[model samples]
Target: MPAGVLFMFIIVFTTLVAVRMNSYVISALIIYVFFSIIGAVDDIAKVINQRKIAKGLISKQDYQYKADGISAGLRLFLYMTISLLVAMAAYKYIPNINGDINLPFISIVKRFPSLPFWLFIPFMTFTIAIFANGVNFTDGFDTLATVPSICCFVFVGIISFISSNSIWSNYLLIPHIVGLQEILPLIGAVIGTLLAYLWFNSPPSTIIMGDSGSVGLGGLIGILFIFTKAGFYLPLVGFIFFMEFASVAIQIGYFKLTGKRVFLMAPIHHHFQIMMRKSGLYKGEFQIKSKIAWRFHILSVVCLVLGLALFLKIR
Candidate 1:
């Protein structure tokens, strides 16, 4: 079973209880589960295909396509459509949530600059979709995606908690988003769940979170930043995921533009793993994987600190 489905349910229960059934928390959980279900469907497809392969029902050539769960075109279509609907619903139904966003260094006297619905919907949708896939890419390594994600939620939780307080928001000069505090419990639930996941996902992993977990959690984080009015800071906080997604994009775009490739393998982590393999520096597969995972974890920690500093201290 994809632990994501169970975790999502747990998150929903814990957050609702923590917030005493806050409407915004309910709305957020619904969106989180929506994306998770999409990923779960893909995960189910892959699982069934694996069973078929084991039974010698799928040929090697056909296995590649079958193992990938849903077709890329179909997956992208769903991401775009669902993201658009979520963005529109967020804008129209969610209280105090709007297209307004926070800038890193800019200070607004009375109001933050806002985007019209026409622009905001597309922008938010893209953010959610890109991040949903970005995290899926990052999950290629054991505990690679889990630790950094925990770090990200830690930063987001702190920021959201502070932003919900008028005194702290004014003191730090961050936007005071009403009802944003309700998300703190949700973040807490997510962080707690990820921590537990990390215990199983550590180097020499027992199981993986898979697409079901990654996509749902990724989509949730994307929207969390938006609700906190810190969408601009996402790249700063989740730079590891951004790089993973970018590496693939760069590899594909560059390969088509020229005959050369950027990384040995796309997603960057795999590239690093390949580089380690070629150098013959790492003694074993376990060491190489652990080394790369640790480096990414450390980098994520650094990013979390810098992102928070810039968000809270540097004007």
Candidate 2:
């Protein structure tokens, strides 16, 4: 089975079980499943194209599957649509949420009053799409995304549980979001699934989670933050993913304007790997071979720890 399919099954099964325990989690899971389906379809199309090429049924130059499986426009439309639906559902079901924007690191808990539905829907849709694609972009290397994801979800789960408990919310000066705690099991399920996926996806990866897994996982984290009123803290916890995404955007923008490559590669991690291989920073060949991925993973871990500590102290 494809790694994407295996991941989908595990998460879907876990979501189903979690729904039985807390039906509210189903809304978030719906967004996750939608992104996963988009990813799976794209993956399947890519596989078909690759198989055709291998069998001499299609010319490599003639293959369009890279761009044909689903157009970027269509994917963006779908992402926006699903995000709007989730936002609307939150509006209807969760009283007072009203798309409040919460800021991080003020002595007092600050919330910007709700935006109109029209503005809120599009604004939130854009935010979620950024997160989904940011994580998708970061999935380029083994364990590059998995460790950060695990850390984010674990902490988000803690935040959710705390936010749902009025006493804890009062003590921490965070909003007490009623019924948000029900999502804890769902978060737990994702964390567990990611842990299993990491076993196969670590260095010398046996299989990759692919875009499907990455986008779905990212969507889950994004929605969880929105639900828990911790959207501001997302940048803190998801700093690595945002950095990866930003590097690509910067590289592209600079190249388009100046016709010069910013880095040997984009997404930053690949740039590190390329630099390690080409720069001869290390005299030992074996050291260079091992250091690239290891260094990236170490940095990821450090960021995760920092994010966790920051959230705890702020909360």
Candidate 3:
């Protein structure tokens, strides 16, 4: 079985055992499970395609037999559908959370309030989809997604605990979210599973989490942000994933509009790897050493998380 399947089981079982289910947590978990299902379907399709190709059951030139797991349109449709369902459920079930958008580092008194439900639904859906794909794109290297994700979950789990407690929420000048504390176990479960998976997924990986894991994890992170009213912090907390997605977006947009490529490769990590090789910093044909890549990425994530935490504490 794919490691992702095992990871999902771990998440579900741990959440069930560790946290009492409430409407809010249940809705969030449902969204996470749905995203995982989409990923599993895609993984299955990819594996099947690979098997067919390897067996010479299908020719590469056959348009219908293209090895790409799922068409972008189909995947987008599924993502949007899932996002809409989750958004609707959140709107109906999650209390003390509405269309208010809080700006991070700003005074708690100020917020973008009373955003119409129609507008908020689409916006929330877009947020989930963007984060999900951002994570999917960032899973290019071993531990690239896993370790940073663990950091994100840890930080978010802390924030969730703080947000849920009225005393801490007032002291921190953040929104007080009732029942948000229930989601902490889900966060803990994710952290535990990722740590276990890291044993085989670190440098020179024996297994890859692939889309099934990355997308699901990303969606869960997005939901956690929404529930805790910490959506703005996502850019800071998930800085690496944000940069990876942004690099790809900018590279594609720039190349198409200016007839020039921004980087040797899309996704900044791969670009750095290419640069390291071309600069003669590494001896191997692969310029980016796995150890270097892992260390650099991990350090970047840790610094960002700690910096954000300190800023939040002192501000």
Candidate 1: misplaced stretches above 4 Å? none
lDDT of 2 by residue, 1-315 (tens): 347667778877876765554435777888888888888888887788889899998888767736346887788788888988887776677674676655545433554455677877676676677788778888876777887788778777887888788888778776777788778778888888888887887666788887788888878788887777667677777877778878988998999999999988998877877777777778764565357556656766676677556555653
What are the runs in model 3 whose C-alpha is more than 4 Å off? 58-67, 110-114, 285-292, 299-307, 310-315
73-99 per-residue lDDT for model 1 (tens digits): 788788888878877887888766777
Q: Which candidate is the best by TM-score?
A: 1
Per-residue lDDT of model 3, residues 88-149, tens digit only: 97887677658766664566665444467988788788778878878888887777788778
TM-score of each: 0.94, 0.88, 0.90
- Residue 184 Cα positional deviation in candidate 3, in Å, after optimal superposition: 1.0
Q: lDDT for model 1, on a 0 to 1 scale?
A: 0.84
lDDT of each: 0.84, 0.75, 0.77
For each candidate, C-alpha RMSD in Å?
A: 1.7, 2.9, 2.6
Q: Put the candidates in TM-score order, highest first.
A: 1, 3, 2
Best-fitting candidate, scored by lDDT: 1
What's the TM for model 2? 0.88
Once fitted onto the true fold, the runs of candidate 2 whose alpha carbons sit more than 4 angstroms away are 20-24, 61-68, 108-119, 282-292
Give the better candidate number (1 or 3) by TM-score. 1
